[model samples]
Target: MTDLVLGPLLRHVGEHTAAIWVETADPAEVTVTAGEHQASARTFRVHGHHYALITLDGLEKGTKTPYQVESDGELVWPLEPSIYPDSVIATFDHEKPLRMAFGSCRTSVSHDSAGNKLHGVDSLRAYALRMSGVTDTDHEGDPDPGPGMRWPDFVLFLGDQVYADETSTEMQTFIEARRDVREPPWAELKDYAEYAQLYKVAWSDPVNRWLLSTVPSAMIFDDHDIRDDWNTSLAWKQEMEATTWWHGRIVSGLASYWVYQHLGNLAPEEREQDDIWQRINSHDGADEFDATDLLDEFADRADQEPESYRWSFTHDLGSQARLVVIDSRAARVLDTENRSMLDDSEMAWLDEQLRGDVDHLLIGTSLPFLLTPGLHYVEAFTEALAEGAWGQRWTDIGERMRQGIDLEHWAAFQDGFHKVSDMVLEVARGERGRAPETVTFLSGDVHHSYVSEARSPRKAARRRPRQQSRIIQAVCSPIRNQLPTGERIGARLAAYWIAGPIGRLMVKSAKVPTAPLRWKLLRGPWFDNNLATLEVLPHGLRMWWASGKVEDGVHHRPRLITVADVTIDKPTKETR
Candidate 1:
């Protein structure tokens, strides 16, 4: 039997359809069975590895059905008499409230005492233990299971699902065995084989694997998935492009990402529209379409052109919320003369999706749209300085500082930031359709969790009698990786005091136009490794941050600890 290698991951579950993704040991016909509905697809080869994405249709809407995967007609998943709960596909229901879990920056490591001591506890694993009813005690500080007793509609993994640059000891061992450790790119992933192995390490943990199987998930890539500060600026890109192995690294990174992460993010219709998918679907059944060449070419072209293909996707969550997950990292325009977080086409696409009508509008970017006011201003200031705001002599130093300190947020891309901010303001004013109850940006990659509220004096001046939608930014980060103590302290001070005033002064002195909105931190700069859940309510939006806490010195198995709870109140008629 060709045993399942990577996943039985439930992806893109709709009202009457569900997509199940899996990888096998070899080429085989993979069958997924949910209740009486069954679908099968042949595994397609890519770099000698086989993968299949099975789409199940004609299912009842708003129903939950336990699903099982079979390789070559032999049952391989939900291994007979499983100790964990059977993985189920839960379709979306408009009548029910929508809830989602989101976070970023996780590293895969052994979930033992050593890993906990080194990386703090793994919040996602702790959550999985809770969901499986394996954890017994709440423990004094443990978080209460919030709103829904049922599973969330889906989980949004904003970015850094796998760390290609910062490999663990285990990954390093694998690399050393295959390639010369002294070579360029060193321990970083060099090609598709390494990336495939990296993914197996990230997903093979039994508890985490179970969680993925049950929870329908969507994902986007951030810097670490390719390399640190990937596409941060033209300088960084040029430096890497000159390297011998950088080409292979990037091609493999994007190609593996397409197979492991991006493919599952697309729905049936969306997949049909994909150029690569069309090639895969057109195969005449005589031989498998080895996507290695096509993917390599596509990745090369995408890296060179930025607008060849779109990686962003949107999900309409049953009239309750609309999720627009943007590709902030891959689709960046890094030309020094035209520095932008997104290209014009991407920005326009985002604007088109930034409409009202849904109860809650969520824009999921790997990087937070709104940082703490202080940090946001600092980024804006740095961008101006980098662009010769200070003087010709300071330009080089400023550019170095921008890349070194990672001042590459949305704020750093001033033009793009302002354009999107205007779109958000218009959407809030009901210029699109009915104003959403909340326009919230769901993000991660800052390595800290926080909530910030945008207060626009300009918007307030033009405000009508109609209630304006609540504009907020919610961030959850480091589901596994913990920030260093010194960096944590620095982040706290920079966000709270040092950065805002000084950065604002610099921007004003540079003669840059004032921002349309002003924002301030409402909740945190918490450094704990965390996962956040957001629930859309009729009146407003409720979000909670949870972390893994080792209780009573049991370092191996941590309990879920509540970090913070926030509520964004909908504007009432009286308040308006």
Candidate 2:
């Protein structure tokens, strides 16, 4: 019903200021004003999404500035005059340190008292309330007494910002109310209107809306954002294409992907080259930019085969570090004969980006670089079995796994797995980039959280007597959703005793050898609603996970789930 649904939210900041990306249902005038300066953008079309990139340059580094948004001369939403609104306008204060809140997986539910109780005032929502000093007596938290808490430098949303597959009761209600659930474009999101409404439900919550309006956010998508088990493998692709509802589903998913998640993730320079979304942003009338045709083609290709495009991008933060945000789902190569995690072009781009001179080299992907030890070992074993590790006899078992008839992950794709793993290790040794202080892989999508260090035999042999190792793996997932009770116990036990030994023995006994890929939990598999923050400090790299806990029957307390003390010096070795 509103012209815009989600965002004028901020993302991808540099030394000066940050970028703000938004969506408008109707082609309208958009402008962002900070202090006395302003920039305006106009939407050229209606049947698709449009992006307005507002960069507040010449901003005082590390200072918060108040901002406002006007559409066709009327304010879309009220901005708090007391505190600033719009994109985060702060530079990285290395000495002051970075406080980034990272989380994923939220459902589109009401913001009523009952919903707040069930959802427990989402971490992002709580951050917003703290910033604005807004409180709901029904929802409990210590109300900040002072002017209010300062906003985080950035909020890293790993994935499932919206769940296209698992719709909540509210989302389903919208879908059913607007169209026939059994019909085309009705069974699921099939057009821009539906996508826009879906976004409204996902982001229009007052608390989250206020949070996004003020704080800068960076996001990546997982399976649920578009469809269930998106790009799991080749066979999964074939099955989805066979369905009557798939075409429109793909169209709406990718079309919305460009609008909601991908366009905003880009830095200023990258946004310039994106022609499709760029075209949408240039529209002046509703009829001018009808992208139903173009988006349809894009959707068809996205599902029929996923490797033809790239939705990934990278950012370099001066000399401090580089963040490589990869599109793990859409850019997959699913052919059994020639499987690859990234298509040739994307891989090449990634290789080029890998070259740098930064303190930390961070790779952000929705899928964790490491899987649960037991499941990971099993997947690795399955890959070996399919590759004829146990002669041709175990091929049936391999086939079943390949069909994604079972668990699928990096280990399942032997060729891609080895390639990415080798590349990551190479970067860790200072082979690429300024031999970063640490090569950290930041990921989500596993529905559990843990930190693992990658120990390579080659690196071990060449280990500097004085230089500390910098290869580390960190994962934080299911920011709002937790794993089922039944599976948690098994997963925890496997992380300790079962996964490593079983995997190693299978590899040795079958003569399908692999270097030691070991993992140990630095944080958790605890099923508590959680979020994590990673900071680079003078002492070393500090990482911690935070969750809201019902300490007493009266209120929820923000608690630290785990803390990892890492150093640039020699860390004690850990193995599977």
Candidate 3:
């Protein structure tokens, strides 16, 4: 009997269609049944694993329908005697408001006290417990959706879905058990099999598993998804290329990412356009068609020639809300002489997407575009110093300092920053089509949570930028990963009132030009394992942060608790 290996992850949910992703133990026909609608697909083999993405169509819009999975004619989903509710396919209504949950930088670890001690708590798991409402381990009562409880229409994982460099204790043991730790790449993942195992470890936790099986999700990659400082610069890339193991590591990273994450990020039509899916979908008379070589070659070319394929994508939600998720890590122009966070082609694509006419424009980037003014200036200064502003001697010092603290953010690539900022300003000032209620940047990577509101500069730095809609940058990071106490001090200090002027002066000394959009940290730089959700309201927007609190003895099940909240109303006056 064929069995499910990993998931039935809900993805690319539309008004009338949805995609279900799964990995089976063997090559088989996987079917997803939602009410009278049923869809099945033959499993495709990649790196010896059998996977299928079943696209279910012809469903009623804005309705909730319970779904089930069967592999090789055997019922598999809704695990026997399960305490959780039946997994449902929820299609959103286009006329309703949009709500979404988002965060990044989660490291898979145990839910025991030890894991909680090392890493605070898994916010995602807590959310599942809340949504699932399973009091005991045994099957008894049915799930209670709770009174007036609002579930997110979708969830976005900004980046660092996996930590390639910082392997957990469990991950290290898995690697050490198979091969000697003394080998090149050491405990780090070296190939596709290792990457597969790592992803299984990350997702197989029963609590988070149920959450994934139900809620539809979208994802992108950041530095740790491949390595610590991937694509920081051409020099860094050259250094890694000289290593014997980097080629294999990178190829496996991209390949696994394509199967495990990127495949589901695409819509039905978009998936058909993918060369990989084209091959997977066109399988005929196959003893499970293998795509190992094909995927590896694609991965290799993607890294070498980023312009050949695009990773960034956009999703339209509700009647006039749009979500644009950017790929900040991989699609970079790393040359120091003309460094940018995105290449020309990627920038052009983004240019086409960042227009107006939307009620709300949500920009999702792994790195926060608007860092607190103090920290934003700090990154800008370091970048300029590293680019020979203080001579070759200081450049060496600057480069070391930048990488040691990981100073590669939007500010580090000012050209790309200016380009995006111009688009944002234009959208905000009604230059696009009609002005949006808000032009917001949602991000997670900094290992802290904060809210910053942007305003046009009183003295025009270069070009005058007027604002009609409120512009905000909200950051919620480290869903599981926790920062060291010492590092937290540096993060908190950067947001101090005095640090802003000091950082600005340093940027000026380094010849950093004045910024068109000036922002102030409105809420926090709180260091906690937090997950945040945002809701588009009639007048404006409302966002709140939540964390997991494992009370006294019930360490296994952490209860969900509120953290902080932010409410943004319309901007009435030109305070700038």
Each prediction's TM-score against the native? Answer: 0.96, 0.85, 0.96
Model 3 pairs in collision: none
Candidate 3 residue lDDT tens string, 467-499: 777889999998999888987887677656655
Residue-by-residue lDDT tens digits, candidate 2, 85-109: 3433555554455556677777666
- lDDT (C-alpha, whole model) for all candidates: 0.86, 0.64, 0.86
Query: Clashing residue pairs, candidate 2?
Result: 43-283, 44-283, 44-284, 356-433, 357-434
- TM-score winner between candidates 2 and 3: 3
- RMSD, candidate 1, Å: 2.0
> Looking at candidate 3, what is the lDDT of residue 171?
89
- Determine which window of 10 residues in candidate 2 has minimal summed lDDT: 136-145
Worst 10 residues of 3 by lDDT: 135-144
Off by over 4 Å in 1: 139-148, 458-460, 463-467, 573-576
Give lDDT tens digits, candidate 1, residues 45-70.
Answer: 88999999999999888888998899
Best by TM-score: 1
